[model samples]
Target chain A: MGEVKHILLAKFKDDVSQEQIDLLIKGYANLVNHVEPMKSFRWGKDVSVENLHQGFTHVFESSFETTEGIATYISHPAHVEFADSFLAQLDKVLVVDYKPTAVEP
Target chain B: MGEVKHILLAKFKDDVSQEQIDLLIKGYANLVNHVEPMKSFRWGKDVSVENLHQGFTHVFESSFETTEGIATYISHPAHVEFADSFLAQLDKVLVVDYKPTAVEP
Candidate 1:
């Protein structure tokens, strides 16, 4: 019931354009204004030099104060709209969540 | 130049036991004590009810105050020891790092 961190990893479809990817990134950042329970959100392209990435190239992370806050953020209309539109452009996606007892301030 | 978040998504080899996973998780947390630049580390197994996870089932996230801090953490002996020993038990691993303009306290 404490703070929960949500991490999302995605690989865009091979044919997706750079412009579309830019839009999606901007769209996600804008959600902070609309989703009240979303305490923070940060995202970026993979920058690891390690050859271990496989095909995933992007990661987005957000934190919520509670489990219900996460549920609310997931079902929020803005989030749903963005996901509905972006899913087709993504070849793969991975979602993981956890409640951390120790977090950086 | 700012806060960087590193997220790793991985799937263990089918035969790996839960005990090993628990050990790896504890090992990462211990790095925060041994590695000076690793500001925080939090990890957990996948808990999403969504079907989008594919074959990945675990994630670990850590934050560093700068790019150099990240490099230090990656090359730290404790991190290297853990990664070297566990690489054989992992089927897939994805590493992503980004500098966030905004982060939750």
Candidate 2:
């Protein structure tokens, strides 16, 4: 019923090269073109001043119009294939989906 | 030069009640009113189908106009005060700030 933000935080393996991570991120961003109901994809590197990030170095967020959209994306062949390679390079990963509720000023 | 998303993932301690969590979230959301450069506040419970959440249960996101804005927020008295009580009730917390780079379809 509302927009869902699929937030994923990842810590790449020490052995993985930056170039490989870039290619993997590119592959992830390209999924919006192949998946349905997935509205957009945005990502960024951690830039917090606080050291509370544990060990996560990157954040990948996918936007969907509905909860069902996430379900579809998970089962879609494109995501499944991408995830297989993506997960292999990550030392740790955390995925969470939330329907954002804005607090008015 | 770009908008930054200050993302925080938190897991409440086992003994904390739902009502207390609600109040904490309310206090968190209210920070926008007192802190400058904090453009918006939004949050949600983890509804992810994937069990990869690693134990994090809630996501709190605050939007800022720039990286400096986030720095200001980190030191702002309102935020620091809120973080004190908020962190006390959390079993774990992960924070990362990122500048969103959109991928065009």
Each model's C-alpha lDDT?
Answer: 0.79, 0.93
* Tens digits of lDDT, candidate 1, B1-105: 468887777889999999987776777678889899988887767666566666778877788897788888878888899889777788988787876654323
lDDT of 1 at A49: 62
TM-score of 2: 0.95
TM-score of model number 1 = 0.82
Return the TM-score for each candidate structure: 0.82, 0.95
Kindly report which residue stretches of model 2 are placed more than 4 angstroms away from their true locations once superposed: none
Candidate 1 DockQ vs. native: 0.50
Model 1 error, position A52 (Å) = 1.7
Query: Per-residue lDDT for A1-105 in model 2, tens only?
Result: 579999999999999999999899999999998998888899999989899888899999999989899999999999999999999999989999999997554
Task: Judge candidate 1 against the unseen true structure and give its global Cα lDDT, from 0 to 1.
Answer: 0.79
Expressed as tens digits, the lDDT of each residue in A8-102 for candidate 1 is 87899999999999888778777888999987888777777666666778888788887778788889999999889888799988787767644
Q: How accurately is candidate 2 docked according to DockQ?
A: 0.80
As for candidate 2, its clashing pairs are none
- Tell me how far candidate 1 lies from the true structure as C-alpha RMSD in angstroms: 3.5
